[model samples]
Target chain A: MSLEKQIAISPAGELAAKLNSAQLPVDACYQCKKCSSGCPLTFAMDLLPDQVIRLALLGQEEQVLGAVTPWVCSSCETCTTRCPNGIDIAGVMDWLKEEALRRGYSIPQVQISRFHQSFLETVRLGGGRLSEPLLLGLYSLRSGKTLEKLKSGELKDELLLGWELVRRGRLKPKLPKKLKGAGEIAAFFAKSER
Target chain B: MKVSYYPGCSLEETAIDYAESIAAVAPLLDLELAELEDWNCCGASAAHSINHTLALDLSARNLLIARQAGLDLVVPCALCFNRLKVAEKALPVPQENKGKTQPPVKVWDLLDYLTQPEFLKSLAGKVVRPLAGLKAVCYYGCLAARPPKVTDKEAYENPGNMEALLRALGAEPLDWSYKTDCCGAGLALARPDIIDTLVKRLYDRALAAGAECFVVSCQMCQANLDLPQKRIAKKAGRDYYLPVLYFTELIGLALAHPEVDKWLARHLVDPRPLLKKLGALSAFA
Candidate 1:
């Protein structure tokens, strides 16, 4: 029986330093598998939540950034809540996704990334609030899921649901009134970018 | 008691039933809920994923508004509450505003706010119609109770606050697994396959535990569980038309509010038949 764990020597400490600066204790993980065991989306992830942390600790920055696990993370905080070591595992995932985007890495989970962009753009245009219909329209256009839905005949179901929601007053077709501090909110985004 | 209400984005659209019911019951509980003027989104699951500072600033702006209004905050959406609470803690100390201390604004999830002893006593006395025959599983979802250090919940997994409120309204709160389970959160929008899997599991567990319906605190959970059940059922070749309802709507029903039916009608799966069968509909009638 092999009692040794394989080690990879690499200059991946850059990712670790970034995570530390972001206040994530990636080094505190001990592979208890508590996080992986509890993550609802673990089955869909290319690397389990625990494996992502292990990669981060090992300085496997390229692999961690390239993996779809972080994008697939729902940020439900299940792993963070259940971690015995008190690691903010979900927070680490969020950082990984941001790092990937910042570095212009090709995200494997394209639709999820596009959805995030669409969501933020909606908030930005709506003056920090989300308008559901506008968001749905923009997301569909950006993700190209609208064409897919049309092809698969799922568009009908979506349209029906939209009609039902609007009828029930659960959704409004008109644009919402922009908040009074729209300029300040937009300036906040601009300053954060700088 | 008065509090600044932050409905978040969902309440303005998808979770309007929750907004309506909360408004409908506010007078009964003697709680004045003033909408936070010109509030914005809490940055939810997406902002943190894209830019950490963006998420913090979005929530901080709202908190600053509530603080400036001189009122404590009451948030109904669990995701909003979690994000706002995290932002409140993580907002960077502005260099220009150094040495100026702002009073801490108390934020309360609606369930936590209503479960306080004084509020519960008032609620109990105002139950014009108790939910006598209704049976439900209180589904807290993930964000509402998780990372207890942030939310300050006593027990994330087995929190009894929602059940306690259910009991107060004379409904049987069934014990079940998946109370704090993840229902795929924002993934419901981007990845329905994952949501389908998660919601199917929740339905199987809830049905096995004899839950007539699911009572939830988060809008995402209600949307995930309610909107996808039909497709999940078709794919699994099973019948699972379980009603996923906001806990606020259930409280409205228990209070015998005339508009409960209007609220229930917004559900994709018609919950009225089940409510009628359980003798829950007559209260609204």
Candidate 2:
């Protein structure tokens, strides 16, 4: 259907209009919970995928965007594949994640907003690639690994694992090096503000 | 026989063992891998989860490089393949590379590339030391086998390429349900409890099906499964030790690469004992 038709059909709800504007097929979902049932990580989500889509159709913008489902989603796409309406449900979650960021709604650890922020920083550190230790280190700092917890040995297991890998000669110490053409990639990312 | 290879960043870090194995076995399989020059990250799950355009742009850069190479791009890491395939899917319609006339570079998951019918037929003839008694389950995770429209994988939910590849190498590939299940990979650091739950579920089902080891192509799945066994065992109150070896590592073993011991040694849960018990370990490996 055309954007005109989508707008005409969903004129009553702000959320529906937003979904249509974003090109998500919000009008097609009929409240079948196949997405919810098939979701592997719903136990930690505040709203199931189906419930969030339903809220979007009803123009419940606050609930739709504020729900932790988007951040909790791992982009597994089982929900998208299993959807009878071809709703691109995982894409919906991605959109919601970005939307939530724009709208300033986030939960620190449970929803992974901090982790993602750290990830972008890590990527920038590598110019356009990823440095594993940098990502872990940045995330650990941003997620607020308190000194008291560190002193209490809360991270003992993780530290022990790190030591083991290092001892096995798996980790080589090095500073992040720029890729040959990374200057162009850096300018592109900066212009996009990603 | 020659393909541009994208090892992804994890292959340099957490999954270095998987990379070492691929380097050892690709030659034996008559596959030549030229690393995609100056390839960077595909933005991974992090870029895609937020900033969809950046995800596409990041992956599009790698795709452009692979197209310049003028060869099919074979990615051993499932996550990198997914991100690149996503960008490739948008090449024609999206404005990023709409006017470029170069032929679209074909992106292939390593397992799918290795399991082509002719390749499998040849692979069967090349296995010198058959892994006769090894029982392994192929854990695909959700990277390469979902959203069929994007990944171009038919029967996405029921992928059999890994099974076909394993069987050709004379290993018994078991039928299992969690083959395409998500192990909560992207959110692993954010919410480890969720990962533990998902991993335990898969492990229980795999154990029930009599699987001795897991063969994974994704390094994220390997880390998610391999790193948590001791914790899960303590929580579930059971002995914890199940090897999560990469598909490439197992192929190295089957092809009689003695240095497989070096790769397998990197795994958290040792796989050599099981291989030794079954007499599946190749000489000196």
Candidate 3:
């Protein structure tokens, strides 16, 4: 066999072990497409939910971690709910997101990851609570979508929606109110520094 | 009855109307929502997606505060409710404080707490200005009940809690297929295209059910369903002027709360004209 075929056929088994660490019953998924059927975000996903699990079961760590399916997963829990074998597919998706980050996989769904990073950054900096204006500003800058839109002269779409929200007192453009338990929240962040 | 209330971060701004609507109708049901002082965000989907332990720790901080009050906690946001409950479940007691006699705290979504048997009885009695002709579908976007294991929700698939509550207030709750379906709330900002798709599906389904509006419990659901109407309309070649509302706002309207008008005004697609048409507006308004 050629080197490419040998590598593709080899079963590393580490990815499956990591997934099953939480008693996820990763081995028990019997190719039931119930998860795939119920998943709402599959239209945007490169691999279906069931297909992602199938690859993981086959120890295809590169294919599983690098897939767009995990990043686009809305964490809606539709697959988890329908899984007859009781695999936490949504939870697994979350794990895959975390794992992808840890392994430095080039995320195809870059904006999605940036949005999540913005959320965590907002909570940490705001002393616990997230500030909406700050979140949008951070996400806009971090994702580079704002700059892209600005260059394309297409930023008006988001601006119009934001202005509408502002009219209704929905999106406030102020600093978040600092909460009392900053020390502990900071400590939690420090201890779990990823 | 008194309960600790965690309004969560959204209530502070985007969904302030939901908070006020709940407050507007709280007194009629004799419900005292003692705010959980100095509580923080549950870290929401962001923390959970990246770090599970941090997510649990964030909500655990709030759970600790709730445990101090020794009261059942009521969370107004569906996402917060799920995050807090997940926190309580994961770290039932603070890791350091394990084996100590800490008072257990039961976390409830605001909708769940309001629809409890005792509360429901009081709510039924307080429906003075009934929303007789108002037609809206109860849209329970995911997180309030999902995964079954974390939420422990018996009625995840076809939850009728909101419908039952709306009926007590004399409004017709329309039946729709996507009641418990995902609205792509997690992808609201990151991928507007996907959110528009998911939300448009909901709008189409709700309108096809002969409904005039979307009654939502989650603020994310309300925002997703409400904010994208113009864009969705342009793309679909149809106008969906469906007014998305907080179920509490409808309750406030049915109970004749004065702030109902103010709450209705905050929504992007105004439900006031719909209310006027249905004769569901407060007399003072």
Between candidates 1 and 3, the one scoring higher on DockQ is 3
Native-referenced DockQ of model 1: 0.77
Instruction: Give the TM-score between model 1's chain B and the true chain B.
Output: 0.94
**Candidate 3 — which residues are off by over 4 angstroms?**
A1-8, A151-153, B93-103, B282-285
Candidate 1 chain B: worst-modelled 10 consecutive residues by lDDT: B92-101
Better of 1 and 2 by lDDT: 1
**Which 10-residue window in model 3 chain B sums to the lowest lDDT?**
B92-101
**lDDT tens readout by residue for model 2, A1-194:** 35784455432477778778877868898988999999998998888888888878877776668777788888998998888898989998888888888777754343388788788778878887788888877888888764744897758877787777766555555545569978867876786674
Sorted by lDDT (best first), the order is 3, 1, 2
- lDDT per residue for candidate 2 within B202-264, as digits (tens), equals 899999889999999888999889887888888899985679988888788877887989988
Candidate 2 chain A lowest-lDDT run of ten:
A5-14
Chain A: TM-score in each model: 0.92, 0.85, 0.92
lDDT score, candidate 2, position B70: 80
lDDT of 2 at A39: 94
Query: Could you tell me how far off, in angstroms, the CA of residue B38 lies in candidate 1 after the best superposition?
Result: 1.2
> Mind giving the per-residue lDDT tens digits that candidate 1 earns over B58-81?
898888888778678999999899
